[model samples]
Target: MIDIQYSAEVRAAKNDGTPIVALESTIITHGMPYPQNIEVAAQVEQDIRDAGAVPATIAVIDGRLRVGLEPDQLKDLGQAQGVAKISRADMAACIASGGTGATTVAATMIAAHFAGIEVFATGGIGGVHRGAETSFDISADLHELAQTPVTVVAAGAKAILDLAKTLEVLETLGVPVIAHGQDEFPAFWSAKSPFATPLRMDTAEQIAKAHATRRALGLPGGQLVANPIPLADQIPSEELDPIIASAQQDAEAHRITGKAVTPYLLQRIYERTEGRSLIANIALVRNNARLAAGIAKALKAQAG
Candidate 1:
């Protein structure tokens, strides 16, 4: 079995059976610049803590699958150059090759489950990219959600994706896409999208019960809690529509495809919105962290 290195805080939490929420590391390494990346990472972790749960920020550091990072490690990772943005496909290779890598949504879910964590918080998930009919650019996150059995809390799929198609694929996969406290599926930076959710749970307790119920029934997958960004913090769908279209046009013009598509489109959107998209992203992520912490607590209570 592969040896997992848990941070001192996470180790203690595990020993005491404290509820823990897993966080992905790509946001630190690839989401923004040095100090700010670290700052936001720390803030999200603290958010989990304030909500009565521990945070396990998973990453591969020098070939080790670290379940949680030390503050120093977090700082170094934030400033580290060329840290590979890894997912299910490349995570093992990076570890085997003794490389440093940041975990994306799929990889984080895999790691979280392996580390016995049932909940994870992230800003957004990748999904059916636009033009998937031809480019066939679907994300591994959907498949991971179908098999990993770790609950993921996100604002929703990133706004740049084809929201309707993403939901359709999740439905086809038999993954429960439960929107938290709302009927409409959230759109990352925006609180509501055009698509309605297939499922909606009003409280973390309800969501947690569903999670446990799935496990008891021998289900093979996790749940997606589409936690909406607070209305005051959201960018609003109407305002983002034209900006998203312009960004997509730019992406096509630049021929950005495959894994490069998301970052490129996000950068374009950031530029167009004068960084407000990023501000909303940070807000939504922290909100998700808080909500995931609640779910973790509820799950833990159920287990007890």
Candidate 2:
């Protein structure tokens, strides 16, 4: 049997068949500091509620795969140290070992699906790294998208990654990359990238309909809804290009590779940008949460 627990509110929602949007725990554990992380998490949850959906923040704690966390649990998680960054490869092991860990995009999708939740909100999905051709360090997020049936709403793949190659891999895997209200795919902090999106969707209802249609046709995997950050919050790609290059160079100089490379580069960029990147990250995540809530609501309505 699966050792999955739902928070009181999530349990009620499940019993009542209300729309519930799944949130990832890594944003609280690994993405930011304590008070800010808790504050942002609560805000995101409230945003989902405001849009008429319940927020189920997924995580694993002491051998239990929690579909949603209580307020105190969120705070405890935010303050915990050395929490495992779980993905498809280690999620079950982490749960089986009674470990406390945060779920990444890939792991979150898996947990959300297990809980019968179909929509997820996240800041960005991981993808091919810059030196993936040599390192072959592609993210499990790609494969998760190709197999999981959860619709992930995000700004897009992190800009620090090889966006072109990431999109190519998603395409080859037959994962639909749908840009929300735009032709160009979003670059985590920015509204547009050089590459075009494979699909364009302008509304939550339309995106939800597409997801339903795919399932109706017996298609495997989920849809990636690449919502753009608000233009006012975006740092133009032109300005970020050089900063990204410099950060990547520093990572290479220090030989940062594998999972370490992303966090290293992100921190370096955050420092180099004087904390602007973090602000942009928060804004994009909130934006994605709002959109994900809308999609979840639409999906629920469609089901009825």
Candidate 3:
């Protein structure tokens, strides 16, 4: 096993068999600006704790793949300049080289599984990018889901991506795409999308049972629990679609490609929306965190 330093809260939680939810660190390093990023991350962690589960916010720093971060560590990471947004490919390399980086969904799953944490909450998983038909810019998150057995709770693929093709590729990879309480798949900041998902489970218990059943059947990979952002917090698709199109056009015109595409699009959307998108994003992440806590508790009960 890789050596990892556990934060006091996570250490105690493990000692007492408390249910723990994993959180990705890229939301701090790449999702938002300094103080706001730290504030948002704390809120999401508190949401899990309020729901009676511990939050293990994963990140790599100073050569350690830490399962949970100390407050000082979180603060420094929040303000650090140019931290590599670590994913499956470079996660190990980052650790080996003693480099600091924030974990993305794919990297978080790799770390969570190593830490023996089964459930994770994130704002949204990356998917096939727009124009992926020609660019073929599918995200590593999809392939990670097909191989890792960690249950991920997210609002869904970000609306900025090619949701149809993302869903199609997920189907091809044999990952379970289960919508929560709704028949329609969620569209990140919005509560629903026109696209249909493969399955829907209305309760956390049901999602937990399905997770256990998959393990029983020796299935590989995890389930994507598509939890929608609360309607009150959502930016309606009708209002946001044109803005998204405009952002994409700007990105294309500016020649932003590959790893740069997502951050570029998100920054543009934030500017265009005048920061409402970030607020909605924080809401969805906290929402996912609460649901993940419930599912983590259920999984513990099932195991016991």
Candidate 4:
């Protein structure tokens, strides 16, 4: 049997058949500083609640996989240091060893599926890193999307990555990447990218229908709803391009590779953007949470 933990709020929601959105805890543990991490996480959860869905923030604590978190748990997690960044590779080991860890996009999708939640909200998905052609460094997130049966809502692949390559990998893996409310795929902090979305969806009902249709057809994977961040909150692609390039250059100069690359690049970008990147990240996550709630509601209603 698989071990799982549920918060009081999540347990109640399950009992009542309420719509719920699965949230990743890495944003709290690895994405930012404590107070801001907890604060932004709380705001995202509340945003989902206000949009008519319960938020289930997933993490692994003391050898058990937790599908939701209490307020105190969230705070403690934010303050915890050296938390393992759990993904497809290490999530099981983290749980079996009684280790506490934060869930990345891939781990969150796996946990969400285990919890029977159909939608997950996050700031962005990871993808092919720059120079991946030589480094072959691709994120497990693309593969998780290829197999997990939960819909993911995000601004898009992280701008620090090679977005075009990321989209190509997703396509080749038989994953559906649908841009929400636009033809162009989103570029994390930016609302627009040069590449067009592989698919476009305008409403929660339509997205829900697509998800259900895939399952009905005996498909094995889920959909990626590439929700663009709100226009007013976006940093714009033009403004972000040079920043991303400089960060990548810095990573290369520092010989950063593997897991350390993302954090290093993001931190560089953060400093270069004068802290505006974090602001945009918070805004986009809240937006994705709201859209994910709507999709969850539609999925529940459709099932009913």
> After best superposition, candidate 4 residue 212: deviation in angstroms?
0.8
**What does candidate 4 score on TM?**
0.99
Deviation in Å, model 3, residue 94 alpha carbon: 0.4
Local accuracy of candidate 1 as per-residue lDDT tens digits, 200-296: 9999999999999999999999999999999999998999999999989988898887878888989989998999999999999999999999999
The TM-score measured for candidate 3 stands at 0.98
Per-candidate local distance difference test: 0.95, 0.94, 0.94, 0.94
Model 3: per-residue Cα lDDT over 1-304, one tens digit each: 4688999999999999999999999999888888989999998889999999999999999878999998999999999997998999999899999999999999999999998899999999999998988998999999999999999999999999999999999999999999999999999989999999999999999999999999999999999999999999999999999999999999889999998888898999999999999899999999999999999999999889
State how far residue 256 of model 1 sits from its true place (Å).
Answer: 1.9
* Residue 68 of model 3, lDDT score: 94
* Model 2 TM-score on a 0 to 1 scale: 0.99
Model 2 agreement with the true structure over 1-304: per-residue lDDT tens digits: 8968999999999999889999999999999887999999999999999989999999999879999999999999999988999999999999889998899999999999999999999999999988889999899999999999999999999999999999999999999999999999999988999999989999999999999999999999999999999999998999998999999999889988777888899999899889999999999998999999999989989988
- Candidates 1 and 3 compared: the better one by TM-score is 1
Give the TM-score of each candidate.
Answer: 0.99, 0.99, 0.98, 0.99
Backbone clash count, each prediction separately: 0, 0, 0, 1
- Quote the lDDT for 261 in model 1: 84
In model 3, how large is the Cα lDDT of residue 124?
95
lDDT of 1: 0.95
Q: For candidate 3, give the lDDT of residue 156.
A: 96
